[model samples]
Target chain A: MYLVADINVEICAAKSCKLCTQYCPEANTILYSDEMGKDQGFKYGSAYVAVDRCKGCAQCVWVCDNMAKNNAIKMIMIDQLPKAALTDNITYGEKSTTAVLASPVVG
Target chain B: MSLDYVKFSNGFEKFMPKEYRDMVEHGPFGKKVSVSQVGSFKEVLEEHPMCAGCAMTLFIRLAMVAFPNPEDTITVGTAGCGRLAISQAAIPFVYGNYGDQNGVASGLSRGLRLRFGDKPKDVVVMAGDGGTADIGFQQVLHSWFRKERFTTIMLDNEVYGNTGGQESGMTNRGAVLKMAPLGKKFEKMDMVQMAKVAGCAYVATVVPNNPRRVESVIKKAVLIAREVGSTYIQAYTSCNIEYAIPTDKVMEDAKAVENDRYQFTEYVSEEAKQYLTERYGYKEFLAKPAAAIPNKA
Candidate 1:
């Protein structure tokens, strides 16, 4: 689940900024909603992004309008089974690399 | 008055003259006073392409000021002179791109790895709205997919040209592009969101005009990119020339347009203005914010 500051857990204020909103290819993320949760009233609404749909491209955050300090939507792998590799050094580009956030130990 | 004299007096007052002698005539409290930062209006535009009015300058304002030793160290190109633009004369070693920014960027990314061997150097590929949205998009993607160490910056100017002034994919819906037959109604593609879904991490969107957050955001973006891996920096870039606007007028317009359109009201509620003052700095208001914003969520 995403950790949002107020009631509207996923909406970014820059949704109105037009920087990232106008350019986003998938119109999936709903940053604003009416059933306003806690402090996240009408001003802030969020969309539930489909994990399968996410390309891991970082566009929703890129297309944000408000320049919010905190990230509203974050991706996390839920329900992982045991027996995954403990140490996986995935090199994305040619030079840089990042360790997987979590990996299970393999026998 | 010769340009030389104007510059000489101005230079002397700042560097050598005493406070009383250096102080130029201050206009009456309410009257408008224009102080030219560059030699002339046109020259300023030509020289400082990145500094001109647009949505992205807000971010540029933050990035350019705080990015120390970019020249001689961090080598960047395009984004219509962004880091590369501001540093042309002031900071040296920034490469210039004629076209094919992405292809060139890929080569640079590859070459840096070979040369530095993961030692770490800032390799910035600055792309303007047209350049990235149209021309450089392919190369940038390849680099991103490969997970290059270089940071690719997109300045969303929203219109095509080095000529013609056609609308690119990044233009806002219904905003008038000079070449648009029906005034550009199609929605813009979300590059930042796309970048995130593409697997790019360390994503962040910033408006340089806010001054409050732009600098911190810029530093954070760059630092994050350096640490986590390749970062795709997309920011709002303003276009005053195509819109046929004055500088200060465009700055004011940027503040209003961006402020009005602000959605996601939950995260940034207290009027971006107040947030800017408290967190970033007052000078951010000195110019317009960036045009493109990255989705970090």
Candidate 2:
């Protein structure tokens, strides 16, 4: 339902806290193994989050502080996270499963 | 809006300009203007060199009292001198609007004690009602316990004068003003009580009914803190502007404060008289002329 990056950042963007591996609605994302990067002269992971098929839902970003701060992952087309854009004081559950809203036509 | 005072939030919000010109850049002190001329009046500071105004005077005085070497000493407060700590006469300083200056003063004093290590008494904290009473109360309380040898001045005008007339923790009972239009119903807090219960080593309350007394109380507070260490002074100041009262009548209100002169009954120990006389020189301190803001610093 949603895409998560396979890599992680070494530092959280705003408070500079520890980084968690890529979190997605499906919870398939994991750490890229390398904490320290030679290019940036610090510990960091690549940001490869694909939020296109995200079903306009946000679960992965809640767990990732870097994503919240720098917005490394953004909606490609449909609807961007308007509510999340205004506030960032939330946390995510361990399971990053994408939640599907029950559309009236579904049942 | 017809009051003789103006809000001190800088150049941006230009809600009231005429009041700003008369009260701030050109002040009520040392000026001779009739009540009718408030709207058209512009402050033409007399030929004599001025010490800016209250916040400026407060900051400058703090530097003289705290930093001995003229090189050290930082100040902190909110709005006017509190927020924008401007340097005058080569003195290093800091300022901010209402909040705990305790942390800033504590850090600076501790730093001076640790790095300079030799000078822990070089920082002065000057705060207003909103900062000292609302936010910075915790910090100042902790600093009192920390026993750092820095002095803190709580300028009590009762309301949060800088923030568009909000009710502050210090607002007096029945004092009808903005924000608390029905008049502040809650009991006004006694900061001296806070200091006493929290183990503040020294405590004093001085008013400008007699400016000499104010300077004396201030000087004595600084001296005692410097000598024995750790103290606070709640300087009871009246904000004629904040209350939308005429500035010309401020002196009358100041004199009236003598009637309500702080009753240090609760916290004052048996040795209060000796302490007042020896420390603040309270009796003599009270003798200074009403208009005399001692230019000691």
Tell me how each candidate scores on DockQ against the true complex: 0.01, 0.01
| DockQ of predicted candidate 2 | 0.01
In model 1, what is the error at residue A38, expressed in angstroms?
Answer: 50
lDDT of 2 by residue, A1-107 (tens): 33222223334322222222212211112212112232445543232222222232233343343333543333333232222110011111221211122221112
Model 1 Cα lDDT, one tens digit per residue, B1-297: 111222335455656432122112211111221211100010111123343334453444335443422321354565453443445322223454544665665676567667767554455666677766666677666666776656667776667644556778887788776688587768887777666666565455544344435445545445444435556666655666676655435444555655755211111112333434454463543447767787879
* lDDT tens digits, residue span B1-297, model 2: 111223356654456543233334433333333221221222221111211123222323332322322223355555532333333322345654346467877776666666754443456676777778778777777888777667777777677765657777888778777777888788788788788777655677765433334444555555555545566777655555566544323434544664675533223333444565685555742445679677998
> Each candidate's lDDT (Cα)?
0.44, 0.45
Docking category of candidate 1? incorrect
TM-score for all predictions? 0.49, 0.49
Candidate 2 chain A: minimum summed lDDT over ten consecutive residues — where? A83-92
> TM-scores for chain B, in order?
0.63, 0.64
Residue B171 error for model 1, in Å? Answer: 0.9
